[model samples]
Target: MSTPTGFMEYKRQLPVDRDPIERVKDWEEFHKLLSEDELRTQGARCMDCGTPYCHTGIDMTGGTSGCPVHNLIPEWNNLVYRGLWREALERLHKTNNFPEFTGRICPAPCEGSCTVGLIDQPVTIKSIEQAIVDKGFEEGWIVPTPPEKRTGKRVAVVGSGPAGLAAAAQLNKAGHSVTVFERSDRIGGLLMYGIPSMKLDKKIVQRRVDLLAAEGVEFVTNTEIGKDIPAKQLVDEYDAVVLCGGATKPREFNIEGSNLKGVHYAMDFLTGTIKSLLDSNLEDGNYISAKDKHVIVIGGGDTGSDCVATSLRHGCRSVTQFGTHQKAPLTRDPINNPWPQFPNVYTLDYAQEEAKAIFGEDPREFSIMTTKFVGDDEGNLKELHTVQIQRKVDENGRKSYEPIPGTERVFKADMALIAIGFDGPEQTLAQQLGLETDRRSNVKAKYGQYRTNVDKVFAAGDMRRGQSLVVWAINEGREAAREVDKYLMGSTVLV
Candidate 1:
């Protein structure tokens, strides 16, 4: 342990975020970094328990318990505490391919499972992680170190998201030639467009892409497999193919008047705004506008919150988010939600924080479900019908949302954004390659093996495992690369 009583002596602290109201006016990252002395003190707060659960990386009760990437949390914390920052960055790179991304956006399940969290707050792990990598970059310690030799093996990676990028990076490190194919006009699939800029700046995504390119990983954008190029052609040409094209099909909210003019999927709205911002700083006026309009975002989680923030940035007259679940209590329920499992509690995320700062209250409506879209004669959305719901369990142990009588309500809305979630990946490529898929429409592949039914083909990340965090995607990608390397060389040195 760095210090015997460090945990007791130093209470957990995180850098204060930029003023939410001021940050909403521009599209930039809102987080600030703590000074070196403060960061070292925060790192010292790690208990470094003999039985640390922070890096266990297990699932419990349908939620993650620890870091999915299995980060060496304790070791890095000690290193940072000792002022060995470069060493801390090196240890961080051992597992995570993109700490900068995860440190910024990941939910930090690791903190929930921390030994210290059983008593006080957990170590500032996520912030320390970001600081380590960011410091590495600023000090010029991170650079492109291409393989000393090439193995003469060629690998094709589908999708340029977290999984695909990590797979490509690992495969290239093993001296394999990697070509990443992305359908979008740029690399970093979800990282580039799906998320808003305020959350993850695009430059961070591009910097990593440039490093991968320098390390001899080729990236091909604007070309989709199974469409612009034949999926079979890749299977035939490359030594091996790894699919990481993520679960992209947004779940449909089919209700009365669902096809109204002002109703759209959450991804569509987010993607358009980002693309426009990157292309011309919104000067082209090619994206959705919520200005001077009352907007309603259906569903909750990060996407719904992002919609709320984006609408606020557009100067929306008012915004409200509808969530299917009840309002979470301020603290975890010990009996139902035990210590190790991620705490299901009420906390304002960045977007909601911005909304509250601007509107004087959080704009989330819990335990509500939208019923139908009330539209005008021109089929333009005007409002949405909703009813409060309560959770009920039947004799069979199946759960259902039961509507409560006399709780029906309607809210005026000029635009409605569906941000529920995704179904699975689009099936065109899988169908074209004659690959099997699970019932969920994810590519059929064993979790550890990542091998599809087809020979020399593998799937990883959300495409194989369904929608999940970026850390899990990186984990699957790294593992899948190892399997691919073994398949190609009849042996493997990758981990």
Candidate 2:
């Protein structure tokens, strides 16, 4: 543990962003890393409590918190503070296969439980975490190491997202010949395209994909197993099949003019933008553009935030976000969300901050719903009709939302991006494979074990757990890998 008084001495110092105004001009990461000396000072602030919540990772639901992959937070922080960076890298790799991605974009829930945070600010754990992995790459410590021997067991992983990648990496380490099939044109599923290059650069994603390939994982892109190839073939050919496909089908709004032009699902806009960037040409009108238009994004999740940030980068004339729920409290409330649990409260994200900076006021409207979309004669959306509402959970545990009287209003918009979240994974592959899915459309797999109804077939990620953060996806992938490894080998040594 660092000195008790050190927490009081340190001011929770960290790096600063490169001017939000300048950053909004392009699709690039804004926050810069602190120097090694500065990182050490921040690391020294860790109290390393005897019952370290940061490492405990215990959530309210009996699930652990520190890290889903169980990265050694305390040990790595101490190693980093002592400048034992190589050792810190080793500790980080003990659990996570790709800290680089998580370090860049994860919400940093671990830092919230930092003992130092009880009084003053929390340690800059996320930035320090990012720095450790970055140093690992700079030192050329990250390289491909194919398993020493083949188990003669072939495994087919049905997704190229983080979950599939983690599963494949571990199964390969188990000496199984691993083959990953991606329906998209490129590997890395949502990582390759669903995420903006600014937040997660394509190069960073590709670097990991390349490493996996060199590690003897076969990647066959542009092949939808249910469409391009038969699902039965995967079962017959491979020793086992692991379904890591993500929940992709977007939840649609049941408002009027739902089929109008200039309206698109959030994934369509995000994925299309990435494809345009990949081709090095945004001139073909393939990418969704919000430039010179009033953009309205419905939903208050991270995806909606991304749409706002992306639209801002496209030079959108104006942007507004509408949320169905009332604004949450700024501070922790035990009755609503107990401490040590994720503080279910209101907070500002990067995009909202950027929007506030540009727009004179924050662009978010809480407890609001779009009544309908108004479109032009060209069948393109022109405006949105909205109303402020109150949401109350009923006795039966159902949610009911009703518009407040006299709160009706209309907002001008040329394009509307529905960011309400995902419904589930596309059903084509599941149906073709004859796998059973729950009513919510998620693949029916018992948590932790990840085995689907189909024999020797498993599911993970958003497909199994529904849409969630990349961190959770990593957790699902890692846990599923353990199960798959055990299923194949009858026992396993994987952590």
RMSD for each model, in Å, please?
Answer: 0.8, 1.8
Clashing pairs in 1: none
Please give, for residues 137-227, the per-residue lDDT of candidate 2 as tens digits: 8999889999999989999999999999999998888888999999888999888888888788888899999999999999999998888
Task: Report lDDT (CA) for all predictions.
Answer: 0.94, 0.85
Total clashes in model 1, counting residue pairs 3 or more apart in sequence or in different chains: 0
lDDT value, candidate 2, whole model: 0.85
- Top candidate by TM-score: 1
Please provide TM-scores, in order, for all candidate models, with all chains considered together: 0.99, 0.96
The lDDT, on a scale of 0 to 1, for candidate 1 is 0.94
Worst 10 residues of 1 by lDDT: 56-65
